[model samples]
Target: MAKRIGITGNIMADQSGPFPGYNRAYVNNDYIQSAAEAGGVPFILPVIQETELLKEQVSQVDGIILSGGQDIDPLLYGEEPLQALRKTFPDRDAYEKELIQTAIAMEKPILAICRGMHMLNVTFGGTLYQDLSHASFAEIKHDQEKDPPLKTHHVSFEKGTRLHSLFGDSARVNSFHHQIIKETASTFKAAAYAKDGVIEAIERTGELFVVGVQWHPEMLTKKHEDMKKLFSLFMDAVGT
Candidate 1:
């Protein structure tokens, strides 16, 4: 049987529609398509406030993909909001926090991307830069204005990491995140780094297949074999 992959969704209020001010739960089609093409049944896990329902949502999926979204609330990591901090949704934060905790407790594999990577770090007691400028060493243009499928920068993989096994020492990837990981979780290791020294990827220290990438592979999977293989790696970890 194919594995069931749950992709976490974002909530947005309808603007100027018949149901104006009404909220909708949605995950980008790229995520669903990437998961399905990677040989897993994809399901969009909507953002909900109910803890029990969130737990049940996680319990049903063979693995979880924490899809990218808004900036994380600075208060989540014990800091006040910075000037460059973008919009944040605390309710979504609450929902995903529960999802991460429940999924880890359940030993489900996780593939966290962009803002999802930020949430994963914060959930594990790590912190973020709030914005790229906050980190002086972040000289590279992480927030690329080019098309989503284009590779904008290069990241060097740490030797012996799963990423290194896939892309060797260095790989070019699409960049689209403003916030960057400030301190990785104690239980996780920085797996890849940009030429300017910003962390590009992270993975749990132990063998649980919990990995996070700063880039959006879902957007590149259609054009890049390496990006597609990243999803395949996650599915392999999920097992049958």
Candidate 2:
């Protein structure tokens, strides 16, 4: 049977006017395409607050993809918002964080993208830089680089780690993030890092199929086979 993958959707940027006033919102196509490429059935899981409703979302899907979105509020990691940081989305934050936690509790496999990756880190007691203005030794331009053909940066995967197992020792990936993993929580292990020691990828340890990447893997899925490897591995785990 084809596996069911519940992808976390990016919040539609709707601030100028009243929301559609609908309960079941829709996810983007990138998530749906990625999951379909990974040989799994894709389902869009809308953002909802009721804690009990989470189980129903988890019950239908064997895995999830926490798609990228706006930067996480610095308050989440006990840090004040920096001047360079852009606007923050509280409702989106609340929904994704709770959705992720609920998914984790279900023991369903999850693959978190850029902001999604950071979200996983914070959920497990981790911290983020919030923004990259005065941080020393910062070299990577993770947020915006339109000149280059692809949207990625160099990342060094740790040896003997799950990320290394899936994509080998090193690879360049899309880097559409300014905030990054700072002090990671205990539940996750640093699997990959930027050239300047910024955490790029992480995995939940001790018998869980939780993986997160600080890049837009969904963007690279069409051309970068390694990105597909990341998704295939996650789907494969879900099958097990």
Candidate 3:
């Protein structure tokens, strides 16, 4: 039997299309493709506020992928939104929060990407920079705008960490977000860090198979062998 992987989908409002007044749930195809490539059956779990339904969905899946999307509301982590902060999804945040909590309680393996990573950090009692500019460290352009994404920075993984085991000490990955984990939760260990001190990767401390990355590995899996291996490793955990 293939491992059932539930990937979180974002809610999008179609303004000009035929469904102008309707909202649709969607997830990036790259995530589904990567899950399939890793030998898992991918399914997009819609964002809904109903806890019972979210719990049911979590119970059915062997693993979960918190796909990237809008920024988390700053108020979530006890901070006011920065003046420059834009685009937030409270509904998605609420849905994913409950879903991930339920999934964790069920001990389901989880892989969080980009904003997904931010959610993990917050859900675990951590905080975020709100905006990269708020960080006092040396600045790096995190929001990379290109025709197609490009690797813009190198992340060094700590020895003996899961990230190090997966991608060695250092590897370059694409950057496409402005918010980052300011402080990791007590349950997670910062596994990788960029040169300017931005957290690049994190892993759960004990037995739980929870890993989050600030970069979009799903987009790079087609071109980067390491990203492919990372997804394979994630699936291996899920299959277990």
Candidate 4:
């Protein structure tokens, strides 16, 4: 049986059609393709405001993938605005927060990426650097500014960590995030770090299948088998 993977979708402006007032819910094809390649049935989960509807979706999906998007609202983590802070989506934040909480409570596997990683941290009472400039290791070259972004750095995983188990001790991965996980949630353990000591990956401390990575593994999966392994590992946790 194929496991159902519920992926969070992003809300973006789409005013080029006859109906020009409404924003559209979208998920990158990379996320969908990656999940499918991992042997799971991928589906977009719109930001449903109805609590019961959201719960119903969560109950059906075997796992959740919090797809990458805009910055998280600092207010969610009880912080004031920083000049370096980027645009945030409050409605998406609220929806995903509730979704994450429900998923964790039910012990469902979660794989959070990029902005989703930051959201996961905040949801668990942890905090994040509003921007890379505010982080302790601000010197790290985390913001890979290229026309079409490419892998530029290697992340060294802690030996024996689940991430290390998937990609060995160190593996080259694409970098595209500015914000870094400053203080991980109490329930999660920092599993990987970059050369400049930025937190690159984290996993739940206990047996719960929760993992978050700061890089764009979905993009790398097309060429790098190791990156694809991360998705495969998540599927294994989902236990199809």
Candidate 5:
């Protein structure tokens, strides 16, 4: 059977549509397409606060894709909102925090991307820069205004990391995130880093196949073979 991949979604307020002022749960189509292309059944798990409902949602999927969205609430990591901090949805943060904990408890594989990566880090006792401007070491342009599929900067993988196994020592990736991992969780390892020392990827130390990438690989999979392999690796882990 093809793996069932649950993608965490974001809540958007309908501004002028039929349901004006109402909220809608959505995940980007690229994430759905990426999961399907990787040979998994994709399901968008809407943002909800009910703990039992969240557990039931995770119970139905073989793995989880923590999809990208708004900035993580700074309070999640015990910090006040900085001047450069962007918009955030605390309810979504609460939902994903529980989702990740439930997924880990069930030993489900996870592939976190962009903002999802930020959530994963916070969930694991790590912190984020909030905005690249806060990190003096992050000299490169991380939030590129170019087309989503275009590569913007280079990243080097650690020798023994899964990223290195897939892309060797170095690879160029399209970056679209303003926040970067400031400190990785104790249980996870930084797998790849940008030329400016920003973390590009992270993975749990154990064998549960949890990984997070700072870039939007879902947007690159269609044009980059390496990106496709990254998704395939996650699918393989889900299958196991």
Candidate 6:
């Protein structure tokens, strides 16, 4: 059987109308395509309210991938979002958060991208930069020009970490956000970092394999060998 990969959809509203409608719910194609191209099945899950429904949806999948999108509600981490901060999707956030927590407890493999990484951090008592200049913006450009999602910069890996073992040495990936990882949570270990000293990737400390990348590897999965390696690694972990 093919490895199953359940991805969290993005919560976005279509502002094309005079009044924004209920279009703030969708998943990224790259996220789906990456899994398919890597010999895994891609499953896009919409934001749901009922925890039982969310749990049942994830129960059938072999792995979970959280894609990039809007900022998480600061209230989740115990704070108020600033003027520059983007509001999170309450339904989407609730669904994915519970999905991730449950998935982890179930010992399922998880791969989080961009904002998804931020969500993972916040879920574990970690905090974010909130805004690029909230503290310092000397860091590399968070949003990339080439890929716009996660195909734009190079980052260094911390030696002897899960990310290091997955994609060894130095790696350049796409960047696409203004926020960066600030407070490292006890549940994770810093894996890779940007030249500006920003945390670029993190791995769950125990039970199951969860690696969250600040960049979007899915955007380059077809053309990039290491990117392909990522999904393969995650799928491998899933079957185990």
Cα lDDT computed for each candidate against the true fold: 0.93, 0.80, 0.89, 0.88, 0.93, 0.82
Q: lDDT value for candidate 6? A: 0.82
Across 1-240, the per-residue lDDT of candidate 6 in tens digits comes to 778888887656677777576566577677888888888888888788888888888888988998888888888888888888876676677877888899887778998988889889988899887888885744678776564444567899998887788778889787778888889888998899888888989998876889899888888786788889988888888877
> How many residue pairs of model 1 clash at the backbone?
0
TM-score of 2: 0.90
lDDT of predicted model 4: 0.88
Model 3 Cα lDDT, one tens digit per residue, 104-165: 89999999999999999998799998788788894888877773346788999999887898
For model 4, the run of ten residues with the poorest summed lDDT: 142-151
In the order shown, what is each candidate's alpha-carbon RMSD?
1.0, 2.7, 1.1, 1.4, 0.9, 2.3
Candidate 1 Cα misplacement greater than 4 A, ranges: none
Q: Residues 1-240, candidate 4, lDDT per residue (tens digit)?
A: 879999999888866788777788899999999999999999999998899999998998999999998889989888998999988889999999999999988788999999888888999998988888886656868877773237788889998789888787898878887788888889888999998989988888878789999898888788878878999999999953
How does model 1 fare in lDDT?
A: 0.93
Runs with alpha carbons beyond 4 Å of true place in candidate 4? 147-149
How far residue 83's Cα lies from its native spot in candidate 6, in Å, is: 2.4
The alpha-carbon deviation from the true structure for residue 94 of candidate 5, after best TM-score superposition, in angstroms, is 0.7
lDDT of 2 by residue, 182-236 (tens): 7888998999988888888898987778888887877778887887888888888
Better of 4 and 6 by TM-score: 4
Model 6's TM-score against the true structure: 0.91
Q: Each prediction's TM-score against the native? A: 0.98, 0.90, 0.97, 0.96, 0.98, 0.91
Q: Which one wins by lDDT: 3 or 6?
A: 3
